[model samples]
Target: MNAQTKQDLLISIPNLSGYDSETRVLMERACVSERGNGPVAYGACLNRQIASLQGAPGIPNLSGYDSETRLLMERACVSERGNGPVAYGACLSRQIASLQGAPGIPNLSGYDNETRLLMERACISERGNGPVAYGACLNRQIASLQGATGIPNLSGYDNETRLLVERACISERGNGPVAYGACLRRQIDSLSTLPGSQ
Candidate 1:
């Protein structure tokens, strides 16, 4: 090997494509993006993917965990199950609020406006006309239902996660709604002990 002329290197940042493509888009928007619009788009895209979610949509010739990750997230938050379902749907909502897009309302507690809104929404969900529904979300969120921090009730749901449950509970019925109510109870109890919220 001999050293002679110096070569200039050009790096190409490829475009994000494929199914869970929304995840890549969202992450990019979440980090480098300066405006809420970009993040908002990512959020909407993720939401659509979640809504039309059929297990995990497989993308041909695509690599990475975007699709799989989104699938896991949906499984945690979206899927329609009998009694055992992941609380990812609630997590998604909270995540949206925490992100650049769904910053939620203002003048509250936690890291940002989104966190506060999430807590308040949780309160409404728990204190409202449903405890079972809240439980459904919490079953997956709370660690053994022994009580958690940042949750709305007796549950220990993180800020963003609590908001996720609140969002899920907002539009559901029957067993789904009942589960949400339980989740809310868990949150309510948890929040009741928080430093500022409790």
Candidate 2:
């Protein structure tokens, strides 16, 4: 990833500073890995690394949770294995709190079903990254879809090039809003300087 993409990924992690030193280091290392995966994959990698260091936490009883919630929790815990049990558990707890209207997570209830599902998928994609990372990830996705950031102007390009630029920008959506806009601006800059692109 480019610097802008890396920066966007870093900022999308909620309350990043609140994480312990080791966890923070793990996240940063994952961000720059050659795997070149999106934020969600990076988060999952972090979970695995943490689990490896700490050994997996024993499974907790899930009798109290409804089937859906229990399944969600089970999948989460199982995904992390024994890596960083504390971080993994805390992330799941934060998700539960968000569902219950806790202050940290945004109110996503009002969005259309499709948009809501996208946001939920965004969060789940980063499931093991912890509350702060996935919380911020969901917020960024919502904001991007809502057009909180302005799209770059592509009027200077021909139809074919413009279509390509738009598609390129959208492909960076997983990196968050900043990277999307940056991708557009980068394309505009690079393409405009080409001999015939003007």
Candidate 3:
């Protein structure tokens, strides 16, 4: 993937809290192998990596890892070959806690309907404003993700190009289509008088 796309994928990965710079870099490199796949595939790759890290010899404990990594490892261990509700619920709780600013809660689609409901309840109890916080956090995350795409350099664009660029920027910031169209209109109006406007 290109650098910008790679960065966007990285930002969308959950469970990164409390990682040291070096460990974070290592995990990013690990994710390189999982690129080009969508988010669910990437998450599966991450879970596999967590399982591998948990099983490696001489790393008996995950004390050196971040809390997020440690919690993921714990979840992996708990869910291994077991469908026990208590263990699953505990794992879900830890997953929720580890993902404070994640895009949203981890997908529970793999669970049965009943289990999914329980997990949602557990998440809600763990985070009182879970859905609201998730929306706000997702917006901030999108802004940061797009900020890495180097979209701010619209210096030499003509009116049409600037309008398209503005629409893209506003949309990537999570604004609605109406806002995007308005932004495009405003950009077209403002840039029409610029020195190089066509």
Candidate 4:
């Protein structure tokens, strides 16, 4: 693709919050190298790369991926580290942290299910106990939580806090308590049953 077209493609992709200048340059190179291929084809290649990095299941069919979806896949791939699977998880956590503080992502519904899930988890995690504090302490806590063998004590947390933690664990980390869904369901049911709920 031409420089302008490449720039446009980069701009169109969502969840590029974690890519630094060097990473962006790499993505640009990848796009240029695959410029002969159509957008869909290029997107598919990027998605496959991401799947490899995440150790996720088979490569998704990217024929249906729009520019935005393709961008997310690209981000996923570019986030991969040489250290292996744990590094990939850490990269994702950092990406999620950066996106949490960014402006609201428009056309969120336009993203595919997986991308939507990622964005939702990021947003939920951003809603901390009180004001959102994107500090080292929070980052350390999230990292430690991801590495912990058991669930942390959340008894003192309110419904929102619990919900955020549960969603992050289930969706982002791929590890959550079996009762998480049931707990969330019960909370939702209780809220809806309360007076004035629609």
lDDT (C-alpha) at residue 96 in model 4: 46
Error of 1 at 26 (Å): 1.8
Q: Best candidate per TM-score, number?
A: 2
| RMSD to truth, every model | 19.5, 18.8, 20.9, 18.7
lDDT of 4 by residue, 1-198 (tens): 799998766644433346454433444454455546766556655544444445433223334545543345335545353323334445545444554555323444554454344434544443332122223323433344353333335576687867665665464332222233345455545656769978
lDDT leaderboard ranking = 2, 3, 4, 1
Instruction: Give the residue spans of candidate 3 off by over 4 A.
Output: 1-12, 55-198
Worst 10 residues of 1 by lDDT: 4-13
For candidate 1, the lDDT comes to 0.39
Which scores better on lDDT, 1 or 4?
Answer: 4
**1-198, model 2: which lDDT tens digit per residue?**
899988877754434465566555545554456237766666656655544545534234457766645555555555443344454555556545555642234667886554466466646766554444555677777667664444466786789999988787776655554456678888888876889755
Q: What's the C-alpha lDDT at position 128 in model 2?
A: 51
State every prediction's TM-score relative to the real structure.
0.19, 0.37, 0.22, 0.20
Off by over 4 Å in 2: 1-74, 79-124, 128-133, 140-148, 153-159, 167-171, 196-198
Estimate, for each residue in 1-198, the C-alpha lDDT of model 1 and write its tens digit: 223211111111233464354454443443343334454454454444444335632222223324533343344443322111112333544333332332222223323443334443444443222222333333333322234333235246567876765765564322332344566665466656778873
Which residue pairs show collisions in model 3? none
Question: Candidate 2, overall lDDT?
Answer: 0.59
Please write out the lDDT profile of model 3 over residues 26-96, one tens digit for every residue.
45556655657877576666555555545233113346555544554454534321422233334445544
lDDT of 2 at 26: 42
